[model samples]
Each structure stands twice: as C-alpha cells, then as structure tokens.
Target chain A: MSITAPQGFVAAGVTAGLKPSGRADVALVRNLGPSMSAAAVFTSNRVFAAPVKWSRQAVADGQLQAVILNSGGANACTGPEGFADSAATASRVADRLGLITDNVAVCSTGLIGVRLPMDLLLAGVDDAAASLAPDGGPDAARAIMTTDTVPKEAVAEGAGWSIGGMAKGAGMLAPGLATMLVVLTTDAELPADALQGALREATRLSFDRADSDGCMSTNDTVILMSSGASGVTPGVAEFTASLTALCQDLARHLIADAEGAAHEIAIEVTGAASERDAELVGREIARSNLFKCAIFGGDPNWGRVLSAIGVTDAAFDADDLDVSFNGVMVCRAGQIGEPRDLVDLSGRHVRVTVDLHAGDRSATILTNDLTYDYVKENAEYST
Target chain B: MSITAPQGFVAAGVTAGLKPSGRADVALVRNLGPSMSAAAVFTSNRVFAAPVKWSRQAVADGQLQAVILNSGGANACTGPEGFADSAATASRVADRLGLITDNVAVCSTGLIGVRLPMDLLLAGVDDAAASLAPDGGPDAARAIMTTDTVPKEAVAEGAGWSIGGMAKGAGMLAPGLATMLVVLTTDAELPADALQGALREATRLSFDRADSDGCMSTNDTVILMSSGASGVTPGVAEFTASLTALCQDLARHLIADAEGAAHEIAIEVTGAASERDAELVGREIARSNLFKCAIFGGDPNWGRVLSAIGVTDAAFDADDLDVSFNGVMVCRAGQIGEPRDLVDLSGRHVRVTVDLHAGDRSATILTNDLTYDYVKENAEYST
Candidate 1:
C-alpha cells in the first residue's frame, strides 16, 4: 500500500502510450475526505518543469482533492506550451472527479525538454479516473517510475491515524530535492500549517540527506494530502516524529534501489562545530568522485576523505581529524592509524565515519559508490 | 625545451627506485641567476601535502634557487614525520647546490597518505643535482609524470626575454589548482613582486578555469623563478600577456591529457550579468556528471546544461536561456530549437555555448567527458 494505505483515499494506475516499453505511465490519487488539507515542496532548481509550476499554484490554497502524475516526459524546459499542457492535464482530472481545477495537482517525470503527448495523457486520465480503487496504491507507485528498479512505499501508525508515502527516483538524486516524485497521505484531522511544518522538517532530514549523485533535477516534487476520516488529532511532536521516520524509510528505499548502485554507503560526520558544518562535511565527502571510486574498489583510502573535507568551510583542525571505514580506524590525527588491510568493503553496505574534533554536532549523508555501471547507465539513459 | 628553454636555467631528471614501474620519478630545476626573484602558488586545499607546506615557507621571501619534485608518493596526511621528510629533502638539494636550505622548495605527487622513502628520495636528489645540465628540461618534464601520458611544455618569447614552463598532472585536475606540479623559469629582468602579480593573474584565467574531474588534490603547486639573465626589462603588460598565453597553453595540455578522457569540452557561458556569474554557470555545467556523461555518449542533451545552470544563483531568466552544441542551436528561448541530430560530437573537441541573455559578460570552463574508463581508472587507482 502507498497513498491508499491511509483511510479515505482512492488511487488508480493506467496504461498510457507515452513510453516505448508500453508500461503503465499514468497514476491518479483521490482523497475522499471529510476535510481537505494539503502541503507540498518542489525542486529548488530555477528552471523547473511545467507540472511543478502548475502544482505550486494548485496547492497554494492548502486544499487538494486529487493528484495526477505521469512518467515518460518531464515536460521541462518546454516553455509556455508545456505549462499550458500541465494546466490542461489538471483541468481534465478535476472535471472527471467533479472537483475544481485549482484543487487538483499534477506531476511529471522523464526526458526533459520534450512536450507531453497530450491526447494520450488525457485519455489515460479518463481511464485512471474510471478505475480508481481503494487497493490501487501499489499500482500508482509503479506507474510513477522512470529508471527506478522497484516501487517504494512506507507507512507509520499513530494513536488512531496513520500516514503513508511513496517515492520514485534513481539517478540525478541530490539535495534541493532529488530528481524524484513523492506523494504522501494521512487520515488524521490536522491543519494545513501543521502539516506543512511537519513535511518540511521531515523532508529536510530524509530526502535532503539522500544525495546519491551530486545532480539536482528540474522536475522534483513532493506533495502531502490529509483526509480527516480518522478524526484523531495527535500532538504536533508525535505527528512530526512519525512523519520523519516514515520519510526516512522511503528515502532509504530510494537509495537502495538507485540505478546501477552496487553499494549503499553512509557518510557520518561527528564532532562538528554545528549541525550545518557536519552536513557540509558529509555532503562534500559524498560528492567526491575519487572517494566514491575508492570505496568501489574496496580500498579504505582515507586520504580522499581528508582531501574532500579540506575543501569545505566546516570547522576542524586538519591534524586532529580522524576517519574510519566500517569499524576500522584507518586514519587518526590526520595520519595512518590501523592497517588499511583490516577493513572489508565486499558487502553491499558500508559506513565511513569522520570525527572532526570540533564540537558535538553530527550528521549523516547517504550515497552510492561511483562505478562503471553508474557511468554506463547515465551515459545511455537519454539515448 | 621546457623549463630550461630560458637562458639561465638548468634541470635534471633521475630515478630513485621509488616507482614499481622503474620509471624516472625525481626532477630538479636550478636557476643560474644574477638575481633570484621568485613567486609561487600552491593548492588552496587545507589538507595539503608536506611538500606543499615546506615549499610555502621556502618561497615566502620572494626568492628561490632550486626546486625538487618527485612522483610515486605524495607526502600528504603523513603527520609531523612527513614534514620532517620534506625539510630533509630540501636541505639535501640546497647542500648539493651550495645554497641555503631556506631557498630550496620541494614538490610531491602520487598516492596520498603514504610516506616517501627518505633513503631513496635523498639519494635521488643527490643524483639529480649532479646530473643538472642546461638541456635537461625535457628529462625533468618526463620525470614528474604520475598518470600523464605525455610531457606538457610551453615557451613564450618577448624580445630578449623568454618564459618556459613544464607541468605534470592527469587525473585530479580541478579548480583550486589541478593536482599538478609546475616549474616555470624566466630569463627576464623582473622583480619578485611583478612576477607574483603576473603569475596570479595568468593562473586565474588559465589553470583556475580548467576543471577536469572536479576532484582537487592535496598536492598542487606552481612556481615562477626569474634568473635576470636576459638583461631585458620589457613592459609589464607585454610580459603578463605572454605569461597568460603560456599558462593557458599548458592548461590545455593538462586537459587534453586528462585521465581516460575521450573529448576535451569547453563550456562557454555568454550574455551574463557579470563575469563571475558566467564562470559560476560554466563551472557548474562542467562539474555536472550527467552533462559530462551525455557528452561522452555523443548525445546532444541540452536539457542537462539547462538543469545545471538552473542550480546556480546566477542572474538569468529561465525562458530566455539558449544552448548550442558545436554551433548548432539545439535550444532557443528555453525550448527545443534546431533538430538535435544536426549536432555532431564525433570529434575530440566539443564546444557547448550557453547564452544567458542577461548581459554582455562571458566566461569559459574547460572540462573532459565522463567515461567508463574514467571510472575504471579511478576505481582501481589506489589498489
């Protein structure tokens, strides 16, 4: 179950002739709510997609009754014609559901700078609206995938309410939101402001830390819709904590299934002067292609880690820094520590810990090693 | 002809049994000067090598007599003992040449976090000092090769004065200085202060814009020494211009010989509000792995370029951007323009020009395409 795991929600996935593979390419999620409350976040890239511009306005009033998402065309860098296409898509979805156009959101992902096939998309919307069902969560999740190998979904239960989420992303995963599309739903009575705050905080901790590659996308969007069918008003802290956990679970799934990834690595930075510094250090290491390549070769080359850290503005003494691969401290006091041969990197999971020896703050960044498969997949992706 | 192409320079190359391949790995350049005016620049990375730390002080007084460079082991992240080793190497060079220890600088390149074999390095320095001759520039150039496929050398003539340089770097080529070791010898009559100003400006326009892999190194150094043997005091502008051209020539060689690179790409950003903004846009595009991969695959994917520009804080209207590949305008007004098939990337040189249409400022960044061999080389580098 994905968005439909929450009560008072229905979803549908339909085949659209937008992809050459003839796979399902359109998904529709409807909230049969006693009350409509919503919040959303979009890619920070200035040159964003048409669907992102449309959804930004649709959710501005903090009310959304339905969402329509499609894969096979990002509809980005297409100018005014693309924006018009997005508006028409939402309008069609709203008309089919007997709802206002402004209460419908749209999302798109795939090749950029291309116009969406409007006729096929519109027909798929009609099919999806007619096929909406309470058990269509998994189908909806699968329809939003581009290069993702598997569908991702997660849930968190509260006192008498629950939250569910689904995410789709593979390559082009970075901060300012990954090249991804995510939809979340909760069957709890909550104000739009509270939901917005919780979503922002949760995404900051989850999606923001999952930097598979240092490439930000132009068509990323994450939307949350709440239906008051559960009628349970939990404490603000409780809701935010549960939402963060659920988002993290979904984020891990995204990294685990990232395109051509052979290993899932976590770079944890501790003993920093501030949380921001810790994050900066971890992000720098995550973005170091040299470090990632060394990890792929199963070589605990901590020198690359030190070189990456030296490029950041984080507070730390070069001579006091320490780095450990897995459980073996390979570098201490900026010099050789334990024998590098003692570390093992043959597993699919690896952890690199760095002690900055600055303060007590800490942060972790999730990333994947740079391998030939990564280059092959990305080189042949758009072609 | 390389560094010794100038009138008052002698150089030598020697093997120290440090490299497993039994290749020459030690270089020495001596200034036979009437006036020893010198200036230099090192890597901006805080976690620099021991040789960098030692050379910083050696050239601090605006004067130097000789430089000792070694490949096969970069004395970086090697603690206090590494510093001692650098000082000892410099002292040995000074002793052999009958100069003060403070006037001799050292440079090292290769695998980081490893200590140099002091016994071999010191012995090699003695051999290099004894072998120094006026026509040994090419030998010195070949000795500093780590992964470089060819020696890079350039000479700029100005009346009776001339400047000659030799550089060695291949993989860790990025801004903050490409993981390079460069020695420049000039027979012009100039003060240390003038050489310093000219070197900084020349490098800012050349080496600073060459970002191959976006992985800065722990050991990058460039030194310019004046022998004052030409007895010609040319205008400062003429000398600066020649130096800039010479540096740009060497920078191009570094990019052309970059590790596993199939194409040398020049990302030029024009019509920017400021030169800084143009560089910011160009560098961001140069650092995008997706853009690099697309170039390697010979795909005219202009969307990746737009997406990269969108991430920067540069001044540009989303709808006003235009991108051209090899003079074929593939994107105009932020949308598809000419047929992408009209652009061909079968050559070794690719020119990607992005028009921001914001103002009149322009800049260019040199980079290389991402390839499978690149990942392979870096992945198996340390092992």
Candidate 2:
C-alpha cells in the first residue's frame, strides 16, 4: 500500500504501450472524500515540463479531485503544443472521473523535449479510471518509474489517520527537489491552507536536501492531498513533522534506488552559523565530483571535502574546520588528524561529518557516489 | 626551451625521491636578470596550500628571483608545520642561488593534506641549482608533471624581445584558474605593475574560462617574471594581448590532455545581457553532468542543454533560446528544429553554441565530457 493506504483514496495503473519496454506507463489516483484539499511543489527550473505547467494551475485553488501521471515522455520544451497536450490529458482524466478539469492534475516524466503519444495515453487513462481500486497504490508507484529499479512507498501512522506516499526518480536528482514525481495521500481532516503550509515545511527539509547528481530536472513535482475520512484534525506542527519524516523516507528510497548508485552518502554539516550555511556547505560538498569519486574508491579523502567546503560562501574559518568520515576524524582543526586509512568506506552507507565551528545550526544532504555505472547509465541514457 | 627561451632565465629539473614512481619531482626556475620584476596569482580557494601561502608573501614586494616547484605532494591542510616546510624550501633555494629568502617562491602539487619530504626536497634544490642552465626549461617542465601526459611549453616573440612559459596540470581544472602551476619569463623591460596588469588580463580570458572537471584545487599558482634583459619595452596593451594568446595556448593544452577526457567541448554562449551572464550560462552548461554524459555518448541531446540553461540566473527568455551542435540547428527558439541526427559528434572536439537572443555579449567555456575513464581516474586517484 502507498497513497491508497489512506482512506478515501483510490488508484490504478495501466499499460499504455508508451514505454519501449512495454511496462505499465500510466497511473491515476483519485480523491473520494468528504473534503478535498491538495498542495504541491514543482521543479524550480525555469524550463519546466508541459504537465508541470498544467498541474500548477490545477493545484492553484488548493483543491484536487484526481491526479494522472504518465512515464513515457517528459513533454518538456515542446512549446505551446506540449502545454495543449497536457491540458487535453487533464480534460480526458476529468471526463472519465466526472470531475472538474481544474481539479485534475497531470504529471509526465521521461525523455525531455518529446511529445507523448496522446491517443495511447488518453486510452490508458480511461482504462485506469475503470480499474481504480483502493489497493492499487503499489502498482501506481511502479508505473511512474523511468530508470528506477524498484517502486518507492512509505507510510507514517497517526492516532486515527495516516499519511502514505510514493515517489519515482533515478537520476538528475538535485536540490530544489530531485528529478522526481511524488504523490502523498492522507486521511486526516485538514484545510487546504494547513495542508499547503505543512507540505512546504516538509519538503524544505526533505526533497530540497537530496542532491544526487546536481542536475535539477525540468519535470519534478510533488503533490499532497487530504480527505476527511478519518475525521481527525491533527495539530499543524504535528502533521508537518510526520509529513517531513515520510518525505525523508521516500527521499532515501529515491537515493537508494538511484540510477547506477553504489553508495548512499549522507553529508552532515554541523556547528554552522545558520541552517542555511550548513545546507550550503553540505550541498557544495555533495556536488563535488572529486569527493564523490573518492568515496566510491573507498578512500577517506578529507582533503577533497575541505577543498569543496572552501569554495562555498558559508560561514566558516578555514583553519578551524574539522571533517570526519564514519566515526574516524580524518581532519581536525583543518590539519590531518587520525590516519585516513583508519576510516573504512567499503560499506554502501557512508557518512561525512563537517564541523564548521561557527554556531550550533546543522543540516544534512543526501547524495550518491560518482561511479563508473553512474557515468555509464547517464552517458547512455538518451542515446 | 620554455621559460628559459627568454633571456636571463635559468631552469633545472631533478628527482627528489618524493614521487613513489621515482620520477623527477623537483623543478627550479631562476631569473638572472638586469631587473627582477614579478607578478603572480594564486588559487582563490581559501584552503590554499602551504606553497601558495609562502609564494604570496614572497612575491608581495613586486620581485622574485626564483620559483621552486615540486610534485607528488600538495602540502595542503598541513597547518603551521606545512608552512614551515614551504618556508624552509624557499630559504634553501634562495641560499643555493645566493639570493634573499623573500625573493624565492615555492609551489607544490599532488595529493593534498600531506607534508613534503623536506630533506629530499632540499637536496633536490641543491641539485637543481647546480644543474640550472639556459636551456633547462623543458626539463623543469617535465619535473612538474603529476598526471600531465606531456611537458607544456610555449614561446611568443616580440620586437627584439620574447616571452616564454611552461605549465603543468591535467585534472581538477575549473574556473578562477585551473589546477595548474605556470611559470612565465619575459625578456622585455617592464615594471611589476604592468606585468601584474597583463598577467591578470591574460589569465581572465584564458585559464579562467577552462573548466575541465569543475573541481578547483587548493594548490594553483601562476608566476610571471620580467628579466628586462632585452632593453625593449612594448606597450602594455600589445604585451597584454600577446600574453593572453600565450595563456590561451597553454590552457588549450591542459584541456586537450584533461584526465580521462574523451572529447574537448567548447560551450559558447552568445547574445547575452552581459559578458558575465554569458560566462555564467556557459559554465552552467559546461558543468552539467547530464549534458557532459550525453556528449560522451555522441548524442546531440539539446534537451539537456536547455534544461541546464533553465537553472541559471542569467538573463534569457526560456522560449527564445537557440542551441546548435556542430553547426546543426538542433534546437531553435527553445523547441525542436532540425533533426538531432543531423548533428555529428564523432570527433575529439565538440562545439555547443547557445544563442540567448538577449544582447551582444558572449563567452566560451572549455570542458571535457564525463567518461568511464574519468570515473576510473578520479576513483582510483587517492588509492
């Protein structure tokens, strides 16, 4: 169970013959609720996909009846015609579900700058609506995968309600949200304003900190919808914390299943003047190809980490910085500390900690090591 | 002949027993001139190497009689002890040449966070001092090689005078200067201010635009010394232009020999609101791993290019962007134009031109395609 694990949500996955592999390529999640409230975040990249433009408008009213997603073409940089295609897709979904067009959101992912096969996609939507089921979340999660090896789903329990989410991403994961498509559903009673605030706060600490390849996508979107079936209105603060944890769980899944990744890295920056500084330092280190390569080689290269940190505008004294790989401090007070060989990097999970010695604020960024497989998968992606 | 091609310059190379491979690891370039006027630039990275710190102070008085460079250890993040080692190396060089310690600059390259073997380096300086000759530039160039495949040397002649230079760098090349050590000798009469001005201007247009791997090093340095032996003073503007061309020539060599590089890509962004904007756009595209991987696969994936451009803060209308690969207009006005198959990318060189259609400014960034070998080289570098 994923999104449909929550009450008042039904979903379906259908084969559209859009993907060359002929896998399930379309999914639909409908909100059947006493109250419908929704919130969403999209890729900050200026060159967004057609479906992103359509869905932005659809979610502007903070209420959505359904969401239709396809994983065949990104429909990005396809100009006005692509926008029209997205609008037509929303119209088809709305017609099949007997919902208003403005309340139907659309998402598309795959190769950028290509148009979707409109006929097959519309037919798939019709079939998905006809096959909608409360237990279809897992199948729906599998349909949105492009290069992902497995479907990602997570659930967080509340007193009388719950939040369930599914995400699809494999590459081009960067800050401002990874190259991903995510849908979250909750059975808790909440207003649109509360849902919107919670979603923003949750994503800021979750999706915005995952910088896999430093390539922000043109088709990233995350949606959260609530239905009043559970009739338990949780406190805004409590709801936001739960949502953040769930998003982080899904983000971890995205990285663990990242395209060609061999190691999942957590760069934690502590003793910063502010949370922003900590994040800036972590992101800079996360994006350093040299550091990533060093990790992949099973080398505790704290020098690369310091060099990466030196490039950022974050508040830190060069001479006071300390770095650790795993539990071994490789650099202390900016000098060689323990023997680098003492730190082991053979494991798939690696944690690099940086102490700025500036303040108490901290942040962590999730990333992957740069490996030959990563190069292979990305080099051969569009070819 | 490289730096020794200019009058009043003597250089030598010697094995220092520092490199594990038993290669020559020490290089000495000395100015035996009627006038000693020098200007130099160091890496902007705050976490600079000990040699960089030492050289900055040595050249602060607008004069330098000698520069000693060593490979196999960068002497970075070594704290006070490393600085002491650099100072001792300079003092040894100065004493061997019967000059003041302040007149000698030191440079180091290779793995960071390691101390140089002082005894071997000092003895090698003695050997280099005894072996210094007017034709020793090429030997000195070879000694500075860490990962560089060849000795880089160039000469540019002026009326009754000339400028000669040598450089060594193959990886960790990025904007604000590549991970390189450059020594330039000029026989023409000039003041330190003029040399500094010309050096700054030349490097701005040349080395600063070459971003091979986007990993800035902590040990980058460029030194320009004027001998004034020719008694000919060229106008500053003419000398600056010649110096720029010379630096550009060396920069090209660095890119052509970038570590594990398959193709040398020139990403030129034109019609921008300003030169800074043009460069910003070019660098953004040059650094996009997705775009670099696509290039390695010989795919004219203009979508990656557009997506890269969309993430920049440069002034450009997303819908008005145009991209061409090898003269084929694959994307026009931000949409598909000619068939992508029409673009050929079978050669070692690739030119990706983006027309922002916003203004008259332009810039070109040189980079290398991400390749399996790149991953292999960087992954195994420290190990």
Question: Over the stretch A295-366, how does candidate 1's per-residue lDDT look in tens digits?
Answer: 888889899999999998899999999999998999999998999999999999999999999999999999
Please list all clashing residue pairs in model 2, or write none if there are none: none
Each candidate's root-mean-square deviation in Å? 0.8, 1.0
Give residue B312's lDDT in candidate 1 (0 to 100).
Answer: 99
**lDDT by candidate, in order shown:** 0.93, 0.93
Per model, the share of native interface contacts recovered reads 0.76, 0.80
Candidate topping DockQ? 2
Off by over 4 Å in 2: none
Which residue pairs in candidate 1 collide?
none
At residue A111, candidate 1 shows an lDDT of 93
- Model 1 docking grade: high
